[model samples]
Target chain A: MDSMMMGAMTQSMKSMPDMAAMDMSVLQACMDACAACEQACTVCSTQMMDCSPACMNCADMAGTMMRSMLRMQGMTAASMMAMLDACIAMCQTCMDECMQHADHSDACRMCAQACKDCMDACMAVKDMMMASA
Target chain B: MDSMMMGAMTQSMKSMPDMAAMDMSVLQACMDACAACEQACTVCSTQMMDCSPACMNCADMAGTMMRSMLRMQGMTAASMMAMLDACIAMCQTCMDECMQHADHSDACRMCAQACKDCMDACMAVKDMMMASA
Candidate 1:
């Protein structure tokens, strides 16, 4: 999520016709959100709450979604859309599961917030892609 | 993962009707392969070759795939199959890219092999699911 990595990713994206026109700022925001969600979910998962499994799933999906954006050359627009949808679904599931325990566990509360942010970010990306298309 | 973590994951899966009859050994082997593939791809990604992006993508996908298996309660059979297919495709892309430089780079060679193993493990899981379905 640093400038240097973003610069490298931007450079890489130039080679893909569908990705060349993407707004770097939007992509960066989504990546940052994904990273934050992944970290939050990871911590939440370690708490061994009932939501742990959903947290684990969301964490991994967020991480993968972030990496896929970083490596756009390995993706087509269709594939990217599918991945974003999956990430969004996973985040929603995790957020719903974590919200149940949010009252008693600070970790779940924070994780749920992270999942919400990530879902919103992913949706923004999807919207951008749709508009561009 | 260690036995304790696996035991916990197995206990968790018992609650999911679709996953109740899963063979833990097969799932364990797939998880091990995914872990190894993730590590190898992470190392290979740092090399900054043409395959670096693909390696990063592969590493994340493999990690996600493994975690999804660990948290089967969050996944349905349809979603799991789609994820497995995506992981296998990512691994194939990474393997193809890494194999290009395998002759000169041990990291690429090992990463390529790891990708192959991960792909095979994912396919085995898919086959198991299909057989049971």
Candidate 2:
């Protein structure tokens, strides 16, 4: 996310006292990871491999996770937590499926790594939320 | 999706014996609803209303749900059910938020209607799954 967008987000979120305290840089990292993972999974899904379905699912979930972070005004801590958990589960599933085909396909290998990175980034946000709570 | 894409989807899922019993038309309707809801939510989110966050979340979940159906080869009945439940919940939340501004915003009204229609379509698929299971 750009500084200008972050400033706009901060302005828009001023009403939410809870979100006002959010670390913009951390959130930005997570969102970027989600976007990257979504793209990787999207490319991997077109491969027509057995992992395609998982890749598609991961792509969708990652995109949602990224967008949700962008729209923090609509979320409660509970809803955010649930969404993060779902994203993590979807990434794990996708990573596992992609790993099976990693040796045969470079796309799957890169996608699996992306999924792992996204899951880690999401976990960091979850940890931050928990600590703040 | 058009008839050509539907035909292609059918060809791709030939390996899935369980999906062979699936009704393509019903699935098509559900996917269409999801796609429409996603588009509506995406537009609504950019409106920067209180509903924007929910709209963004709905857009992501709806898109994911639609793509997952397209890649049915990757899902089990259980995973499909979970995803449908998540999508329905997200749509209901978005619709509720958008309805709050329906009197003032045409976009919100349209997005709310799309969410409702998507929820109905998803429920129909769930009912079909239950019957088949």
Model 2 residue runs over 4 Å out of place are A1-11, A17-26, A42-48, A76-79, A127-133, B1-4, B17-21, B42-48, B76-79, B130-133
Per-residue CA lDDT of model 2 for A27-111, tens digit only, reads: 8889999999999999999996688888888888888888888888877666677678778878888898899989989999999
lDDT for A25 in candidate 2 is 80
Q: What Cα-based lDDT does every candidate model obtain?
A: 0.87, 0.86
lDDT of 1 by residue, B34-130 (tens): 9999999999999965888888888888888887887788776666776787788888888988899999999999999999999999899989988
Candidate 1's displacement at residue A23, Å, is 2.1
Model 2 Cα shift for residue B7 (angstroms): 4.0
* Candidate 2 local Cα displacement, residue B98, angstroms: 1.4
Error of 2 at B104 (Å): 3.9
- Each model's TM-score? 0.77, 0.77
